[model samples]
Target: MKKSLSLILGLSLCALCVGTSFSQAAATQTVNLAVNSVQKIAITGGVITLTISNGTAGNNTLTPVSDATSTYSITHNSATPLRITANLDAALAAGYQLQIALAPGALMGTSAGTVDISNALAASAVAVVTGIPKGADAGRTITYTFNANASAGILTSTAKTVTLTLTN
Candidate 1:
C-alpha cells in the first residue's frame, strides 16, 4: 500500500515539474503573426511630366528637359543605380552644361507612399533638394549642352507604376 502511495506522489511531482517548465517558457516569448515576403517588379515607358513656372526660367534662357529623354529607372543589385538622362533644345551662347539631380520631395506616383517616381526609386532613391548634390546640371540647362552617364543609387521599391519627377 505504501509503495502504491509513493508511486502516485512521484507521478504528481513529475506532472507539476512539467507544467511549471512549460508555463515558464511560454512567459518569455510573445506570440506574433506570421510575416509575408514580397517580390519586386519594374515597368517600361514610365511617364515623365514637367510643371515648371516661369520662375524656374533663368538667364532669359531657361532650357527645358526634353520629354524624349527625360526618363529614369532603378537597376536592382547589391546597390541599385539610377539611369537618368535629359536633352536641351538649343545650345547657349555660353556653351551650357546639363545634368541630372533629384527633386526636392517625393512627387505623386499612381502607386502608394509615392507621389511621383517609383516607390522603390523613391524609398531607395533621393530628391534633388535644390541645393543638394546628385543632379547633372546644377541650376539650369545650358543651351546646346548635354550631360549624360549620371547615376544614383536608391533604396528599393515593391510596387508598379513608377513615375519620375525632375526639376531645375
Candidate 2:
C-alpha cells in the first residue's frame, strides 16, 4: 500500500508541472499619428546700392541701374497653390522708379520677370511669383532696378522699404 501511494503522488506532481509549462498569457495596445500644414519664407542679403552716374551721349534718358546680389528662400506644404507679392512701404518720388524681379525654382512657380514697384502700395501690391507648388525653394535670385529720367534730375540718397508677401 505504501509503495502504491508514493507512485501516485509522483505522477500527480509531474502532470502539474507539464500543465504549467503549456500555459501562456498575452497583452495588446493602440497607437495614432498625424501631421499639419506649414509655410515659411526668408531673405539672405541686405543693403544693396544702385547708382545711375553714367548716361549715353546726347541721350535725354538716364541709364537704369540694377542690383542682383540678394536672394530669397521658401519652404511650404500646402494643399493648394500659392503666390508671392511685393510692395513698398511708401510710394517713390515722382520721376524715380524702382523695379523688382524674382527667380523661382524650375518646378516651384512662374517668374513675373521684372515688375515696377515704384508706386506699389500695401493695398495694391504687385505679383512677382505665381502658381507656387508645395515644396522648398532655396537660393532664388532677387533683382532690383532703379531708373531716373534726365528731367527727374539728380536725386539725393534715399531709402525705401520693400515688403514681400507669400500667400494664396
Candidate 3:
C-alpha cells in the first residue's frame, strides 16, 4: 500500500508539472523609411514683349525703357541651401545693355527684393539671390530695362532676342 501511494503521488506531481501555465512576453519590431530629396526651379512669363518709342530723326538712338517683366518661381525641395542666378544668352546691341531688377519687397533665395543684374553675359551668371529655404514655391518678378546709347547705330524695327537664363 505504501509503495502504491508513493507511485500515485509521483504520477500526480508529473501531471501537475505538465499542466503548468507558461509565462509569455510579446515581441515587437520597428521599421524605418525615408524619402528622396529634390530641388527644382521654374520660370513663367519668360517672354518679354517690348514696345519702344521711335528715336529722333537725327538721333540714332532709342531711349532707355522698361520693356517687360517676368516671374520666376523656385521650388526648393532639397535638403541643402540653394542660390539663384541670371545670365543673358547673348549680348545686346553694341552700346546697349539690358538691366534687371527684383521688386522692392520681393522675396529671393535669401534676401528681400534687392538685386540688379546689368550687362549680364551668357558666360557669366549673375547672382540673383541666395539662401532659398526647402519647401514649396517661392516667386519673384524681375523687370527688364533696355538702354541704347546715342551711337547705337541706325535703329531698325526688327525682333531682337535677349535670352535671360536662371540657374540654381
Candidate 4:
C-alpha cells in the first residue's frame, strides 16, 4: 500500500497528541485549620456549717459573731485571668483553726478582710483569692467569711470540710 498508509497515518497523529496533553493538565492543593484555648469552672455553694461555742480549757478559741458569711454561684468559660482556691477535705481537731476570707467587695480586688485564709482545713489547695477577671462571671456572687479558732484548752465538737477552687 502507500507505505502502509503512511505508517498508519503517523501512528494516529501521535496518539491524538498524547491524549490531548494529559487532558489539558491541571492540579491544585491547599488546606489549613487550628483552634485552642480553654479553661472552665463552675461552683454553687458546695457546703458550709459552723457552730462555735466550745472553747475553754486554757487557750480557748471561738470566733463567729461577725465574719461567718458564705455565698457561691459561679460559672466559667474563662479567657484568661482567674484564681480562686480553697481546700480542707479533712483535719480540724487538735486545738482547731479555720479562718477563711474573701468577702471584701467580690471580684477578688481585696479590701474587706484582705484575703486571709488561715488553718486551710487541711488536704491542700489554699490560695483564697487572686486576680479573677477574664469573664465567666455568670451569676457572679462569691462571698466567703468564716472564723473559728481554739488552741487554749481545745474543747471537742469539731467538723471541717470545705473546697471551692478555680485556677488559671
Candidate 5:
C-alpha cells in the first residue's frame, strides 16, 4: 500500500508526520481534501524548513507515475504550499528532469524555497525516497531528498531558496 508524508512548513519547526491507509475499495475510492492546520509561521527571512521523512520501509512515493490520480498535500500550517509542486512533474523518477517549483509568491529562499542536499544525503535521503519538497527542515537544518538510486548515490543541491530576502 502507498503511504503519505505530511509536512507543516514555513517555520523553524520539527519534522512533519506522514502516513497512508489503504482501503479495499481504495483502488476506486473517491478521495477529498481534508486539511488541519496544527501550526503556523510567518516568513521572516528568505528561508523556511519542513522536516519530512519517508513512511515505513522508506517507500515515500504516494502514487506511481504510472498512476496519475494518486494525490497528496503539503500543509503549510499558517502558510500555503504556494503550489510549489505546482511546477513539479506529476511523476518523478531516477535521473529524470525535475522542475522543482518554488512557492509562486514565495521566492526561492525567503518567501519559499528549498536547500538541495543531493550531494549531502541527509538522514532522510539515506532512507531512499526518490524526490522531496522544498524548505524541508527538522531542527537547525532544512534538507530535501533527491533521486539517489544505486547508480548515483550522491545528488547535488541547487540550494534554491526564496528569491528575495524577507523581514518579519
Candidate 6:
C-alpha cells in the first residue's frame, strides 16, 4: 500500500508539470513598418499640332494658333508647398513665340494662366502652377499657344520640346 501511494503521488506531480509546460509554450516576433516620401508627375494625351495658316484680310499680323488637347497629372507628399515650372529645350527664334497655361485642379494648385515660355530655360523656368499642396491632381488641362509675326515669314517646319517640371 505504501508503494502504491508513492506511485500515485509521483504520477499526479508528473501530470501537473506536463500541463504547466504545455500551457507556457508560446512564440513572439518583432515587426517593422515605414513610409517614404513620394513625388511623381505624368503627362497624358498624344502629340499635339499647331499650325498658323490664317490671317485677317490686309492685316500684317498672322493669327495665333492654340491647342489644348494635352493634360498632366501629379502626385506628391511634400510637407511644404511645391510648384510646377515650364521651359523649352531651345529658345524660339526672333518674332516667334510659344506660350503655355495649366488649368488648376480642385484644391491642387494655383494656375499662372497663359505664361510666355518662348525663351525659358531650366535655370530660368516659368512657374505655371504654384502653392501646390500634398495630394494627387489628375486630368489637368495643358494649353499651348504658338504665334509668329509677319516678320518671321515662312519658317520651315521645326519641332521644339516643351518640358514641365515639378519642384520646390
Stretches > 4 Å off in candidate 1:
21-78, 87-168
Clashes of each: 23, 0, 1, 4, 17, 0
Better of 1 and 3 by TM-score: 3
Over 138-160, each residue of candidate 1 has an lDDT whose tens digit, in order, gives: 22211111221112222132122
Better of 2 and 3 by lDDT: 2
**lDDT (Cα, 0-100) at 55 in candidate 1:** 21
Q: Can you tell me which runs of candidate 4 are displaced by over 4 Å?
A: 1-35, 40-59, 62-83, 100-127, 135-164
Best by TM-score: 6
Instruction: Give the lowest summed-lDDT range of ten residues in model 1.
Output: 108-117
Compare candidates 4 and 5 on TM-score and give the better one: 4
- Residue-level lDDT of model 6, residues 1-168, one tens digit each, is 999999999999999999999999899998888767878888886777788998887776789999999999999999988999999988989988999999979789999999999999888899999999999998899999999888788878888888889899
TM-scores of the candidates in the order shown? 0.22, 0.80, 0.59, 0.28, 0.17, 0.84
Off by more than 4 A, model 2: 1-34
lDDT of each: 0.32, 0.90, 0.60, 0.56, 0.28, 0.90
The residue-by-residue lDDT of candidate 2 on 1-168, one tens digit each, is: 999999999999999988887775556887766657878888878888889998888877789999999998988899897899999999988888999999998989999989999999999999999999999999999999998888888898888889888888
Better of 1 and 6 by lDDT: 6
- Spell out the clash pairs found in candidate 3: 110-130
Q: Give candidate 5 misplaced runs (Cα > 4 Å).
A: 1-85, 88-147, 161-168
Q: lDDT, candidate 5, residue 167?
A: 15
Q: Which sequence of candidate numbers ranks them by TM-score, best first?
A: 6, 2, 3, 4, 1, 5
Error of 5 at 132 (Å): 24
